[model samples]
Target: MDTEKYVPGISVDSNGHPSEIGIEITPEAFKNLETDNSKTVPPDGETIVVPLQLKATELTPFDHIGLNWNPHGHEPAGVFDVPHFDIHFYMISAEEQLAIPAWSPETDAAFNNYPPIGYMPADYFTPPGPATAEPQMGKHWLPGNLGAYLPFSKIMIYGSYNGKFIFVEPMITLDYLLSDVDFSANYSQPEHFEKAGNYPTKYNIYHDAVSGNTYVTLSDFVARN
Candidate 1:
């Protein structure tokens, strides 16, 4: 059916309407993981633990706006730690964030080998825990697919102080996403990022919408104004 919902991971119109993409990814290529699929995209469910230590990197354009702009919403910027240099990305729920301790350089190297903070294979997905007791979830152990949304609404990154500077490659899906996820809801005309606050007007020329979630190199952002 034809509709005008905002799909996260997809770009949006100036009015926040979701733009259509040219390609499609069916179940053949993209797995529709139930709480119990062999691939276990999110093995547990609501909680997928990132294996790393992190320090707070400046909250990009969003930080400039206000971390709690939503009054009570997820922070778009992930935390980073200078000691360990690990990054924690995609932390949408507060529960997930509270699960781990602040980043520590000493733990960065061996934390992966310990339980409660062990690393799972990208394919070894698990929700926060085996199940959630939240009334919203009913009696299922998996997350309540209450709406047509993914497990997490935002993405974040946290890394130890010295592990590496390689950013987590963005994991984008050709599938649909929620409206709030598609656009920088907190961003307005002047507040939007100017590709690191520098560049020419033409370099900032953006399409009505974009094609992916990962950051595209803004060679244009560096152009002289």
Candidate 2:
């Protein structure tokens, strides 16, 4: 967790271009911040580092931030910060799974579903600043809030390999990914999403097993009127 000893590794820019400077991280270090919930443990070897890019105007820099996907407009909780636009890739090997005591022939199917490499966007929202508010009466009703504080994107690859999350140094920018797109695009519009046959509840990146590629889709995170 001490980034002081971390070194730079191979990384890619937001456009998927290769770069030489990436922040290297170990599984032990990653576990300090994230858990192996999917249980896709990595093997013992040279740990790979993930790269992140910061906004030019951002005064402070952070390797990672918790994303607050508050689709229902409830009270916010935990430390959340806007994510950096770019993410880096990390790879896993089959030997690591073999090293685990729980390794079994039946587990091969699970491992096959995971990609050998993955990339998670650095973007997230910063904790809200303190603000006073008046209490509402029991009979008062409020309309749904449908705006994103910041652009959110994250990708978890399946293994063809996985580990703890490694949030590292800057590499690419978000603008590079959506290059040439009209600035008028509105992803936060609930009505617009419905017209397009999409739900505006919760948007996320999904991986296609047949195509070996990732795509984004909008679905309900809560009941929508």
lDDT top scorer: 2
lDDT of 2 at 119: 22
Per-residue lDDT of candidate 2, residues 1-225 (tens digit): 343323333333475433222233233332333123232222111122322344310211123221111111222222112212222221212233223322234543332232112222222211211111101100001112213322222222111121222222111222222332211111222221111111123333333345333222222322223
What stretches of model 2 exceed 4 Å from their correct place?
Answer: 10-20, 34-225
Candidate 1 residue lDDT tens string, 1-225: 011111112233474332321111122322233333344433322332222112111111111000110111221223110111111132223342334343345433322321222221122221332121111111111113323223433322221111111111112222222121333211011222213422211101112333422221112112111
Assess every candidate by TM-score: 0.23, 0.18
lDDT of 2 at 19: 23
